[model samples]
Target: MAHVDPSAPLEGKASKETERKLKRESRTQIVSFVFMVFITTTAFLTVASDVIPSGFAIPFILLLASVQVIMQLYYFMHMNAKGTGWVNALIWGGLFVAAMTVAALMLLIGITKY
Candidate 1:
């Protein structure tokens, strides 16, 4: 039988592989956050610049914000792999319905009866 070395770190101690994995995960979160920010910032800038017609700005901004919210829910909230499937479906469904209602109202209010 071989003797165990007391000077060596225990198996539970952080190994290089574990550290690398953590660093990689951290980078992923950073990247996701940065991309979300970039998308929203650009969307706001476009709306403010009046480069696109006012009719297009609201839809564009809402679409971009929805995408960012989804990304944040999946990446930052750790909901990508966890169960909670019903909660996810329910919330997103509600949001979709609300968005559709708003869009329909906007169309009705802006359109001419003639």
Candidate 2:
């Protein structure tokens, strides 16, 4: 038996299907990254511009932030990939619980304020 180097780089051309998949994935990542950058720029502009009132800018920035978070999770984190059903469910469940907790706390605080 011959010893082999485990850390050696892989050799040979990948299959057509694999190459195509890789190209598609790279394209998607590029697009998502561009989109995220655009979103960030828009958020910064919204906050920096004096024409937009603080009332509107705050919510607009928040909306952009939410979109960025979702994109990061789905694309950068590969949450949208196959065989991630359980992971997706658990993450969504956690989000739901967090949202509900925030809502309940807001309501409690509001009631106590009165």
Strongest candidate by lDDT:
2
| Model 2 ranges with Cα > 4 A deviation | 1-13, 105-114
Error of 2 at 11 (Å): 6.5
Which tens-of-lDDT digit does each residue in 1-114 have in candidate 2? 398998999899999999999999999999999999999999999888889999989998999999999999999999999999999999999999999999999999999999
lDDT of 1 by residue, 1-114 (tens): 299888987667688998998899899999998998899898989788957987888898888988988898888876776697987898789988998999998899889653
Model 1 lDDT at residue 45: 95
Q: How close is candidate 1 to the true structure, as a TM-score?
A: 0.61
**Candidate 1 residue spans exceeding 4 A from truth:** 1-18, 86-90, 93-114
Q: Distance (Å) between predicted and true CA of 1, model 1?
A: 29
Evaluated at residue 111, the lDDT of candidate 2 is 100
Error of 1 at 83 (Å): 3.3
